[model samples]
Target: MNSFWAVFKRELKSYFTTPLAYVFLVIFLFFSGYLTFKEGFYEARQADLKPFFVNLPLLFVFMVPSTAMRLWAEERKVGSVELLFTLPITIVQAVLAKFFAAWLFLGIALALTFPLVVTVCYLGNPDIGLIVTGYLGAFLMAGGFLAIGCFFSALSKNQVIAFVLSVVACAVLVFAGMPTTLNYVSTFLPPGMVAAVEGMSFQVHFDSMQRGILQFQDLAYFVLLIAGWVAACAIVLDERKAS
Candidate 1:
């Protein structure tokens, strides 16, 4: 527990010390506001945040990866991963600590968007339940993206490589919903298997949350996605230790 907290603190501080936090905040705030207005707030004749939530996964593809690209890659680049091993902590502890720090950073960015929620409230009698659930969906979706980023970050010593890999992984997750990808997946599969393949996408799961319906299965999908990536990261890093 102590070791986890120590790694968490160190990782959190590292985020603030770089250009990542500032750049992402600027991009996220600008794009979100731009989309909110462009989508026509009160004039759109709808209280739904369809415009806002639609572009969410797109924003996360870049921003979330940017935050996580350096978590472990930077350490490996500087030959400091050995120093981490020299500590009295296990690889899982380090992975969780860094993972949690990245997750918290994503949460903070999402929280900072509260004014958008307030604006929606003031504009109309929007469903607060929907807004709350949408935010939850966004947060969980971001976690899934970040976990994939963390995996790529641990797999390489080059931060740029990690960034590109994270982007690709996240892109595939989002793009699984595209007609081409879905068709391809369904080609050789049975009805139930096709359904299951399409269901593996983050888009399907997140859309359910954005609509204010919190299904246990959607929530489980997110939890399992994050857990799978984090577990893969730990396993790969463990191999790095042996090597």
Candidate 2:
């Protein structure tokens, strides 16, 4: 536990020390606000952040990868992986610590958008329960994307390659649950198969939470997906260390 906190604190501090974190935060907030007010029709919509939640998954497909691209790729690129391995911490601790650090950084960025929540409340009586659930879903989805990015990061020494691969992989998950994709598959595939594919989509689960339904299955999907990817990352790292 102490080792985990050590790595977590170091990684989290590194984010603030570097300009990447700041730049990412600024870009995210700018686009989030712009999309909510301009594209989301915030002025005209009911007192809710539906539009913002609707755009989050797509935005995360790009933003979250950029944040995670450096988790392990940078370590390998700079020959620091050896140093990491020599430390007192186990690989699992190291992986979880870094994952939590990046995840928390994203959480802080999301929290900074509280002004939107304040605006909605002032405008009309909004369902606070729904709004809270939306944020919960967003956070969980962010972790899933980050875990995917972290796995890809472990596979490459170049940060750009990690970022690109993460984006492509995450994009597929985001679109898999879309109506258009399922519709295309339904033309040839059986209904069961199409339904199976849709069930695997991150969007499908997230949309449920966006509508204020916090089913255990939806939450479990994200949790299990994240664990799977993180476990994959640990395996990759261990193999890389051996070879």
Count of clashing residue pairs in every prediction: 0, 0
Q: Which segments of candidate 2 are over 4 A away from where they belong?
A: none
Predicted candidate 1 versus true structure: per-residue lDDT over 1-243, tens digit per residue: 599999999888877898878888878888877877785666777766767888888989988998888888888878788999899999999999999998998898988888787777777788989988999999999999999999998898788999999999899888886668888877887878767767888898988899999999999999999999999999988886434
- What are the Cα lDDT values of the candidates? 0.87, 0.94
Give me candidate 1's TM-score against the actual structure: 0.93
The candidate that wins on TM-score is: 2
TM-score to native of every candidate shown: 0.93, 0.97
Candidate 2, after superposition: displacement of residue 164 in Å?
A: 0.9
Off by over 4 Å in 1: 40-42, 183-190, 241-243
